[model samples]
Target: MALVETATFECGGCGTCAPSTWIDYDRLLYPVCPEYGRATGPLA
Candidate 1:
């Protein structure tokens, strides 16, 4: 069997979805994280 790769992106400014950790196997990268500025939730 063969393997396939794909990339996905999302906006962090508006917390429409839950945050996620990023992983890059090809290149070395510093620990990257998303910054949620404004969000609407039950706690808000």
Candidate 2:
């Protein structure tokens, strides 16, 4: 059997933020604004 893991992203700002699916990555999740690329967060 193969192990499959999944994760989700929550926008640190308002719930209205939506990030681009194309740029989705592990490191980019933190300190990034969902609507715009910026440093700020607790993305875990």
Top model number, lDDT:
2
lDDT of 1 by residue, 1-44 (tens): 88955554344434333333342222233322244443322333
CA lDDT of each candidate?
Answer: 0.35, 0.50
Q: Specify the poorest-scoring 10-residue window by lDDT in model 1.
A: 23-32
TM-score to native of every candidate shown: 0.23, 0.31
Clashes of each: 0, 0
| Candidate 2, 1-44: lDDT as tens digits | 99965544455564434444423445654445545655456544
Model 2 TM-score relative to the real fold? 0.31
